[model samples]
Target chain A: MKDEAMALRDTHVTLAHGGGGQAMRDLIDEVFAAVFQPPGMEDQARLAPGALAEAGARLALTTDAFVVTPLEFPGGDIGKLAVCGTVNDLAVGGARPLWLSAAFIIEEGTEVALLRRLVATMAEEARAAGVRIVTGDTKVVGRGAADGVFITTTGVGVIPAGREVSTGQVRPGDVVIVNGVLGDHGACILAARGDLMLSTDLVSDCAALGHLMEAVLAAAPGVRAARDATRGGIAAVLNEIAGVAGVGIEIDEAAVPLRDEVRGVCEILGLDPLYLANEGRLVLFVPEDEAGAALAAMRTLPEGAGAVVIGRAVAAHPGQVRMRTLFGGSRIVDMLVGEQLPRIC
Target chain B: MKDEAMALRDTHVTLAHGGGGQAMRDLIDEVFAAVFQPPGMEDQARLAPGALAEAGARLALTTDAFVVTPLEFPGGDIGKLAVCGTVNDLAVGGARPLWLSAAFIIEEGTEVALLRRLVATMAEEARAAGVRIVTGDTKVVGRGAADGVFITTTGVGVIPAGREVSTGQVRPGDVVIVNGVLGDHGACILAARGDLMLSTDLVSDCAALGHLMEAVLAAAPGVRAARDATRGGIAAVLNEIAGVAGVGIEIDEAAVPLRDEVRGVCEILGLDPLYLANEGRLVLFVPEDEAGAALAAMRTLPEGAGAVVIGRAVAAHPGQVRMRTLFGGSRIVDMLVGEQLPRIC
Candidate 1:
């Protein structure tokens, strides 16, 4: 069995590998099943976690599809991003992510070595996030019908009894805090694409935030809500909170953290850093009395070492978000209107 | 809000609709959220079904990616297939599907009307299958980077207490039963492609089997296992059961059910019906004593009106499947070797 498993001679994926025949079985056993180590070959994974049996605990589910260009990039690849993206989606909802299902659509003629690297990275990320890759499926499309590969990951988690986190939970006088530098991921992808003739030392801030979230919840049980600043960055998140909570948000422009490299990229590209995407950063809302505890808890983790107060929710001007400019003027920060960076995730 | 919701003026999808801004929100609200009616706008869906709290109950997870060409087909489109495929995966494992997460990878310039139709069909199918589409994501890639659209659905289900179904549970005396005529889906897809220049009245046998499976389980509590005969058809499923259970499966060629139209298409294309796909067919293994009850239960449902016994497990030639020819000769029915019908699902 070991010899046959190691004897996959195909250099590139083919239509036959997705035909539900011997070739597909060989590819799955040698590549994905080898790395993921699922519990069985059944069509579905059976899970009986203790968390689900707890009284009043709710199940949380989320999904994301990754279609980034230049499949591989500095700091992380599509595989790492897929895992972290879904994990953070659950974590921000106050759920403890437990299992994930990964489905891949691979174009014919994709290199098998590249797939192996992606699978390995996914396994590593799943391990770091303490989640299991329980079930998955693969499909192959004809050349030109699809890019090299697109991955969709679905995550399952358990929200503890009596725990609730939502955008609508934000209230007046709640302090807004963010973890780490913003726009590093967006700046890194722009430089990685190499289309604009730019170079930078910045890498994607794509890290799973489940552990950091758990730490914060433990330290400040009164945290109102949390949202990962992903596709539309912090600007989108703040606007969503304001609309959903029916409150006004005011942010101090200087208090928003930004790395020098990211700032330089935004300036050179004539872009606003506020709308650039980030993978690991999150905006958290807590009551004024617990804001210090939340910030202290976040700063204890390396991923959140730059945690700081970026803004606060106010009763005036409900359903609006405004930024207090460094030059002493304030302007409304509206939701993104159009595409600033495509496929940044 | 009502007028704004109906004012999706864009005829075709563009990068802006996936830019995590107002456009994306409008698209989601008008096209998806309006139909699926997810409970909240949070990153994840919070579910507290009573089934999860039951003692000994287990959660089931499965995922599948659909990339069939000609997005629309005679009997169903990719959207219906996505929902049915994931639901059947959970159903065949003795689980009652409850929720699904759908993620789409769409090419820029695809018609918005096409997307609306697909989402509507998905909503209809989910309603029929008794499952909720709780969360979803959409990404738009540059033109030519992807086909019309690819859907990946992840399903969550629950297994009742003490219910166990596995390929390894098929005993030597188990009887193999099929729910309906085989190969209709594969044959229909071939004719629908338009490249073959063949026309047929046959339609893809695509339907959700959750209710049928529940009925069967209720009728025959001792059934060993069940498998949806999808991509590589009954041939692949039989071979897998034989290998996993360490038992030989013997079938009578004349007893296997088939439609004349499907048989004609297979004959013209020099394809074997045994290796053709069926979206709504399943192979079940039940104890000889309970086969009658199981078949009778299946026959009560329209999806399984043609249920019949096609084969039986035996101790001889363990780990292999064989067919009895009409001329009194027998031959081994090995697993499929290569692609017969690509993207037939």
Candidate 2:
């Protein structure tokens, strides 16, 4: 089997590999099935009851499509981003991710080596996050129909009993905290593209936050809600939370952490770091009394090492976000109206 | 909200619609969120326990990516096909599909009106199939990066206690049954593409088979296994079952049902009807004694009006499929080798 897979790896993927024939079977068996090692050859994965068996435990389901350019980037590739993105979506909702279903839409003539690398990265990330890639499907389209490859990962998790998290749960007195510095991933992608002729060594802040979130939940039980500051970055998340909760959010610009290189990239591009995407960063809304506990717990994990309070919910100016600059000026941070950066994920 | 959604339907999809900001939110809200009406605004859908709570019940998870060209054809569109495809995958495994997550990768510059039509069809189909579109995500790529729109749907179902279905469970004496006439989907797509200058009113045989499968399972409890005759059609399915169970399959060519138009299309294109895809078809392996019951149960549904017995498992020539021709000659029916029809699903 290994020999067969190795032989197939020397060629680019063809449409026959997705035609539901012997070639397709060989591709699936030798490439994906060998690594995933799903338990049965059934159309669906039969998963035994776990946290879902507990009383009052609810199922958490989410899906995301990854279409990042330059499939391979500095710190991570699209595979790592796909896994981390889905895992974090579940984690921030206080759900323990258990299984993921990854579907690939590959453009014909794509190198098999690229697929192997992406699959390997996915398997490694899944192992690290303690989840299983149990079921998947692949479709191949003609050249120019798709960009190299696109992955859509759907995650399944279980929210333990008594664990309720939502933007609506955020209250006026809640304290807003972020796990780490902002915009590393956005800046990294910009430099990686090399379109602007700017060079930087910044890597994507892409990492699974399930473990870090679990730790924070244990330490700060009073945490109202948590959200990953991803595509729209911290600004989008803040605006969404404030709009949903019908409250105002106020942040101190000086309190927000940022790396010098990331800040420089944003300044050069005339973009605000607050709206730049981040893969590993998240915002936590905790009760004022438990804010310290959340910060302390977050600081212990490498993914959350730079945890700090950047803002708080307020009763003034309901359904809006404001930031106070170091020069004592205040400005409203509204939801982005148009495209700032495309396919930043 | 309806006015806002109506106003946005005039323009084409832009990068801003996928930027995770206000424009993205508006597109999601007016186009998708309004129709799907997912339970909450959280990143994940929190689903209350249902059939999963039963003792010995197992969770069923499956994913599929649909990149059908032309987006729409007679009888159904991509949205309708996406829902039925995932639902049928679960149903054939003796699982009750309960929820689905849909993720879309749309190319920039695609018309928003087309999106609305797709979403509307999805909502209608989900209602008819008795499943919920609980959570989803969307990403947009630049023009030409994608064909038009690609949808990946992940389904969650519950396999009730004591139910099991797998290709490996087929026995030598099992009887084979299919729900309906084959090749309509493939023929319809060929006509829709208009590349061969063929014209036909044959519509795609795309429909949700969950209810039909449930009825058959109830009536024929001795059914061994079942598989949907999709991509590579019945030929691929038979090959897979034979290879897995190490049993030979012999089908009666005279007994297999095919529409005249579909057969004409195949003849013109020099294609074998057996190798053409079907969106609403399945082959079931049942104990010889229960074959009548299974056929009776299947015929009770509109989707299975043409139910018939076309094959049986045999001990001779293990791991091979043979067909008894109308001329009384037997021929090896091997798996498809290359692309017969791309993006048929």
Candidate 3:
């Protein structure tokens, strides 16, 4: 039964798939139900109580909606992004990702073949993240009412006992480290859109980072906080951390990691890579004494091979972030005043 | 802080609100963060691990997406539907609804005031259902890229100790009971659209059924199975139960509870009340011996004032649903074949 459902695909979807009828049931049975294969046939998925007792002392919940245009992109599609986006959010909050629920809002004329491909990717990613896609819902809108498809994934995880991670824990003399090169996702999506009329071999850095995060936590138990540099890039993350912790952040512009192609695209577009979004990158804060070990641990993973110490926390200029320029000058890095990019995620 | 942020409203939403920038943060603080007020500033909401210990031995998780048009209708809006839709799914599965995560996809140019009104309504409905909106995500797309707004809500709940429910447990001679009048929600949305050129003061029967479901479970703990009549209506639910349990169901048309206005609308439009979607209705399969007490308990609640025995489970014609008409004729009530309604919830 398991392998039999793997090669199946449907060409196009109709409004009936979301009508809560036999057509919908057939669609689910053939596509999602076969893949998920939950324990029972209840409308809701059941998780045994105390299931997380060994993993953590608390539950972490988060959700994200994926509406990235060009559903399929250079390196990954919306499916991989949806899974990794929610999983990364939980991981950055010091949670061991466990279960997820997916809901889809699909246009009536969307090809079922596309949905199958996306679901397959989701299943593969869920397996990589060691989580289950347990429950889901589907709704279909008219042809003109929606884009091709929109996916919203919600995740549940367990926070380890006695391990509290928050921006409030950030203090002076804390080093800031990022997992990998910045802006790969944002840059890749822009180039894929073909609006810039520029071509680059850039691929999105969309991936599940739970395993890498776990490795970092194991080596740097004293890590203060971590955040996925997603929508607003590392600049937004630093500003938010500074604002919430009532501290200031200083980053060396030359020390920040960036791909030459990404740098080129940003330069041509007159956009700052500092504010470009990322899908598989994160910013970590650790006390000065523990920073070395954290960076070493992160560097061991392929996902974090480009890890580097880009900044540090300070008590001066409370609630502010500043960047040291490559020209040996400094300037304030303010929270984005308006939208520099939209639908980049 | 609780009440200080309510007065601000932007004339319209822009790309910045979803850009993960100051504009997005301010909007979240004013609209959602104020209402939810989750503890600590973290990427995910943290919940005590033992919180569900007293409630039951398992957790029930479900998700639903709401794309109902017109945003607002006579009795309820899309916000109310989003909360109630997911909550009722858990409730019908015999779980006490607990926490919810809401994700919103908004089209640029939507009125911020409209979004605020919807968010306020959602908070109110969540409070009424004894659930908290703990985590969320928001995304904005270019104008004409999406409908006005779409919401997908995922819920987590706890099943009570020693309570077990499944369609597999249904048996012959078991009576079926519904909590309230049918099709009000479906009828209301259609009229609200103004496309039918018909309006008769009918409002949607959109309400959280958790409280009412609790009463039913307490009265009939031995109930075989239960299902909420939402997307495909009671007809779809009945057909599913019949097919799953490998049993036949027979319903008396005269016994089904319905409102005159809804019936009039259906009659005028050549629609069957049984096939119209509902928001707060449920069908319970109770043993013949306990059916009377169950119906009585349901009728005591305001949400279930129209409670009545509509049918009985039978062994004949296994895996089929047969309906006895008011004209003394019987016909197979098969699953919905095509899209009768789209974006109804």
Candidate 4:
């Protein structure tokens, strides 16, 4: 308790905070140390004089910038999004997440109160993800540099040597699966914009997926690929796999899960749920024989309760993705030309 | 090569390009593989289906968002700046940067030509730094979702063992050194804003510090700490060390090196040169006994030619930073209230 108060009092982040000095120490010891441990990682202890300790884990690095308009959004804000976004990236890549470094771009007129809330939320999110927020950089743009706040988070994780998977490994006949419903992230952003007049008590599907992924990878050793369905939706994902593997994919649209409320909103907005964004959910591909096992494992995790086999890889129409509609028509599932939800992540 | 071209043609990046599929793979191979080389870092190699690689290297990760309006400035553009920004971070942290992941936010109406140029520049910069641009993502926002282009880059580096350094190590009488001139980056940004009627032909001193840092650390074995003089500039950095080490810093005004043009611009804008930013420079804290050797070693490097011993650590006023005026009057160097050049990164 004494340490917490001292940290907060002595080290709450300030602009000069990232300058790398006493303020940097207080920030690291008080704020970063209290949560995820990043004191020492490798050769850094030798090279980095002020580093806490050498992080013992093998490194997995991911960087993301948060520019969700409204600064504050339904279910989450830029701060929360920044931390979870990087956390999920590491998770899907099968990395045990570790330290994070953040940089903030603040507009000249940004409200101090809001910035405080954002930072606090960021700290909370980092702790929740079991990672430490270590070093940082901050810059103020003339009222035009950015909106209220744009946060970029870079994270390092440890990936065990044997656990390597890439989109290249996916093969024909692999059953494509989604952990849960999609479009929730994009829909919430649309709702937040309020210009859509779209009202349906919907919130974003943004949540961390580390634990959920751990469950699936543990249960199904045959999981060929994994990716969070954030931008470019499921269709985009299938096309990506097809293009990478020089294969084709066919989806049973009826089997793809969606919330009726979200569907209705998308219908009104002319938004293709296939192209809409999802924050919390992931799309997985596995051998046909292992699909069932993957599904059962996914169900065991709360975030993946809606797990379903939505598609399968095909040899025909190599490098293309297609879907069979409930109406009995088949059409090419194309990559979205533009963003369905801009600044969504 | 045939397979690569076909792969590139089949999977075009779209809103769902980041969706983790063939499209993602295609883009990764077509775009990224064309530029970077990582160990087993090719697009086709698969991560072990259920295996994870716990990072073997002591890791340092940094994320930065580029909102430098006008995008292109003298000496560099946003693309070049983006790559260098993240690289410098890892370099200053005493890490051998290994990989970089890039994410882009494109506002509606942004010219594809500009985006292409920026990307090419990014590739060029990465190559110059001898680092790989491994993973990437792109999103197009609605017209108002963002400005022209905002890039987020994340960098990962391996820090050697036994080189732990931090501001917490500041000791009374420790010598302070700077790699080169300060305020050039920020002033160049202001001059480019063009609205200032800023007539000087000064360009931003933006470049990767990894090489220069490599040289300094190779020779200055006793170097205590190092930091890039970036946002909030020199004062911000000094204050940070003071607060962290629980020591005071005293700077000799005449000893602080600055470009004549940069100084004039700061004076005209009523900006404090100390609060400006530097992209290609680093601040080194070394024990007094080794300060001369460190500065001498720095002078031998092209990037470090402007190295100067700016100040020394003092036991009194443990958390204050004092800068002696040219006339010999010492003034408290407080934290910068706001940025001098907004969004210059």
Candidate 5:
């Protein structure tokens, strides 16, 4: 906090910081450049040729925009969400996340101290994700023109040789698994809002899963597909896989893992745990023979300590998902039709 | 517009379009994916390994955000600005532009027809730039939470081996040159707003300069520096180069190119043409002996037909910029102190 105060004497963002002059340069130099330490000037980042030539693989590119309300959350902030979101996108595509670019859209009158904290959080998160923020941009709008701040992150990574993970690879007998408990992120955000008149000792499960994903891929080379359960949660991921592969997914409700606090919150709010978002969790499908090894490898990592086999793919009811409830009844799970929680990240 | 109407029954954006479900998929398929024709699904875009391996050089990454007012102008729209902006950043850094990732933050209640036009414009501009729109993300915020729309674009390109362009290469004897007329973009946007009750036939100078930059580099391999005159215009670029190289720059005001329409707007509005924004213009520095060759090469391209030698670097008055007036007077040209035109891109 003291570091932020000394960085910028102004209490709020001003028009000059986005004027593309000395003020803008000072803001970038003091905040972004101080953290990124890019090789050359702040305009464009030039990477070493030798470093890339040795990777020797095609690059995977992905992008996401984060505009979650209440910039700061229980366990993490928008900065962590931006880094982990882009990194996980690359990781799920069978790529090793390497570089990222962050662009900020800030509203005038937003506290400069808040921006400093956010940039610091982003730098820390980038280091944790094993990626460098190569280049970035900042723009400021009038008070009503935008919310406090919105971040758009883009990432690049190298796909290892002969690695192909797609829904097309799924088979009828493929086994489905999840890395950890679901709905922690969404539930935590809801509680943080302080509108539900509820309280719980829940923290967001936001984390960068590149390392854990690498471990799983190493153990289960035959993994058919992998996707993070983000916005529409595990239910949305299953439906997507089913629709693309033209297969049926059957989940055992008893085997799906969830924290008691998350389940309680969902029940009170009339929301289903399956449709809530998760940041640190991923749904993976592999051949039946490789599921055990994949789960064992995932369990070794703290982020995936709750890894479990939740379901299997089938030929019946093609392009559909069905859950066998704990009461021994089956029900269809379809794609969410409308917004549930806006800007929950 | 007719296609947009047929695609979305209601013309305005809805919360469901950003829900990460069927609605989002349909929107992407009908608008973005249909135009981009990305290699794979919207989750991630994978580049062919063989293609990248052949490039055999380091990569350059850059990102920029566009919140320009008046989405549509005489010569270009926000889409063109977003694409050309990032592409120029890479080209100025001596990188062969390749791929781009675009992210959009749309306000709810905005017309889908407007979005379709913007996306189409982006696709066309990307084609002209010889780049691919590989990956993208979209988010929608409630009305009043955001302005109409904002775009953030990130670009990746490979820097050819042995190509070096930086302000550090600048020397006291280097010559300065500009590609074309200045202040056209800023003037055009100002007139487009209609709030000033001003009318003119002027159009924006927005364009992707990858090919033109490549031609200049081929003709003048020993060029010391290059930068697009965007916000803060040529004055900011000169001040930056002076500060970074610890030298002085002296400009001949009579030699600087400017359109009559742009000059008239600046004079009537009490604005300095040197501080107005430009889209397609660039400031390049080279050795005095090679200045003629660079000018000849630039004139070969339509975008640089107005290229001229405008200034020279000096060892005295280090880190300063002074311009010789048409009346034989000289004055310091320091960095822009405060806002001139907001959201000028």
Candidate 6:
């Protein structure tokens, strides 16, 4: 029995743990199943489908991996970042997320306390998002294998019938609008690292987007496109739609919203604000005819109060995105090229 | 246009592609959208719901990142290895994988020919696996910023109803079985490096398992658990099943099969055969009553002529796995403590 216990301790990160073995079983029941479960997802112990169909009317699935540096950072840590990132992915994708699966690669000796806190935060975030954590995985690595923790989250959700929206439908003359601020996430992280100081109190704009999307999506079909400007800001998303729809995108830089603090930081950093990332913001492409209605709908929601039209899609320069300068010259807006401030997600 | 094209090539691994801008759009259309494109999928060119859904499902939804060292080794290069490795993951997971998303992080000046061969092999392997090379990403890094190239392949698949299975249900008293020899994958990888020339005949057991799994699934519902023994080998799998079912597992070491060459190599390497990885084989758990039938069904299949019962689940010592020696002493088996080899599959 003592030797058995030793084996248990020693046999750290094997395929069997992921295999649904005692390790896999305990990992799931003790760690994962506890945190990521959406509500009504009991009986996770059994192999049979659990409470999925009962309250499963709404569901969405989103998966992403986290490889941020300095595992622990201000405002949030990797664990919180991992869960919220996927939650937001689903939120902007327009689904009521119910369950999530977190797969982790842990460097050997990741402090148990840190893991515990991370797990606790995962649970907290899931609870905050009103979702359940039903399943997950843990993999141990050799020394020098990797640093700290790498988390991959796959979330599942259900979209209620009759709420169809997509980026492909974005048409020429569609007014591009954004909800609230931009670059706050990237700026806050930068400040948190002591790279800059915020004039106003600044915090990472890391938060779930379910309610915000729900608000805009509820107002119906005129909403042509929605995106969370994470790595490349609004310019990137608008360009994507234009390229996809074979149209040109023209953005009014003056009207493109940014928190003053964020603008100040970006200016000081010599970073283009359009290239900065945003976590707690939404970009919408709406038909010019429905632009007013969309803006009115956006302002009515707490999550969308600062909404404004920032661009339009044109028939010319199909698959191109451009920004009208404050000085009246237009410049091509492109996607981010590489790691712009790593871990800015 | 020239500037745009040059800009696209200038930045090796920009963050923009993920951002949805001109570069991101161009990458998607030129690199991804063009290559992938099987008959039914149209170039929607936008983030349409159907496009996302189709992209997610039409392929196998298998994502794996390659960080293997000695980038080019025996049997295959990292490029070939990454593509095949991911393809195998999809094949075994029961996906008629259609398209793939390849994201690469290449240390600066990786031989272009090596990458071309890798891409070619990816195409070849995709063709060989009856899949497609739809989307891809490339990022160049400063010298020493990375290994030659790290490839993450995200596969997609459409889950045919009534086909999804998990490792959470192997019952007590279920018989454990495996296909052919174990440790071939690890052995082959090691041998291919020429660190030890114990055997020049070592070939990787890397192959798709979908057809084999389909054949086995078609044969019996008594089959409770099925897993491809990859990283942590056969012992890891047995341990996982025992834990999941709240039962004990007893596998006869004598009955657990291994190749003579593999056994010889492990002895020289000071590694246990049971801990070594095998890419092509699957460990199956079936009820005792159906063991005979399952074996017969498996034997008739393409990947299974060498199938045999290696062990059985016991009610004793719940959540534990024990291996019986030829002389009758028992030893407990457990999950792998840490990664046996980093960057291996």
Against the native chain B, each candidate's TM-score is 0.97, 0.97, 0.96, 0.87, 0.96, 0.79
Instruction: Give one digit per residue, the lDDT tens place, for model 3 in A32-142.
Output: 878777668877998875545544578899999999988999989999999999999999999989899999899988998788899999999999999889998888888
Q: What is the C-alpha RMSD of each candidate to the true structure, in Å?
A: 1.5, 1.7, 2.8, 5.7, 3.0, 5.8
Better of 1 and 5 by DockQ: 1
Selected candidate, larger lDDT, 1 vs 2: 1
Model 2, span B159-237: residue lDDT tens: 9999988789999999999998998998899899988898898999999899998999999987899888889999999
Report residue B277 deviation for candidate 1 (angstroms).
1.0
lDDT of 6 by residue, B1-345 (tens): 224554435334344444434454554454434444532221111122232233223212445555655566555666666666555565544444545455565555555446556666666667766655543444434454345566665554443444544556666778888888888877877776565655557777766565666676677655776767776777776665665667888889899888888888888878887878776778887778878877887788666888999988778888788889889899878765544554455
lDDT of candidate 3 over B182-276, digit per residue (tens):
99999998898999999678888899999988888888888889898988899999988987898999999999988899999999999888889
Q: Write the per-residue lDDT of candidate 1 for residues A1-345, one digit (tens) a residue.
A: 113643578999999989998888888888999999998879799988579789889999999999987799999999999999999999999999999999999999999999999999999999999999999999988899898999999999999998988899999999999998999999999999999889888889999999999999999998899999988899999999998999999999999999999889989989889999999999999999999999899989998899999999999889899999999999988887678888887
lDDT of 6 by residue, A1-345 (tens): 113343334333444443323454455455555555432221111122222233323224445656555566656777777777767766665566655555566665566557767888888877878766554445554454555666666555556554545677778878888887777777777776664444446666666777667767666456776777776666666666675667888888888887777788887778887877776677777777777877777788666788888888888888888888889999888655544665454
Better of 1 and 6 by TM-score: 1
Between the candidate structures 4 and 5, which one is better when assessed by TM-score?
Answer: 5
Considering only chain A, what is the TM-score of each predicted structure?
0.98, 0.97, 0.95, 0.84, 0.95, 0.81
Listed in order, each prediction's TM-score against the native is 0.98, 0.98, 0.96, 0.83, 0.96, 0.79
Which runs in model 5 stand beyond 4 Å of their true positions? A1-7, A49-56, B1-7, B49-56
- Give the runs in model 6 whose Cα sits over 4 Å from its true position: A1-33, A37-63, A70-74, A91-99, A107-110, A130-134, A140-148, A157-163, A193-201, A315-343, B1-34, B38-173, B192-200, B315-320, B327-339
Best by lDDT: 1
Model 3 DockQ, alpha carbons vs. true complex: 0.65
C-alpha lDDT of residue A30 in model 4? 46
Clashing residue pair totals per candidate (backbone < 3 A): 0, 0, 0, 58, 0, 40
Q: Lowest-scoring 10 consecutive residues by lDDT in candidate 4 chain A?
A: A42-51
Instruction: Give candidate 3's root-mean-square deviation (CA, Å).
Output: 2.8
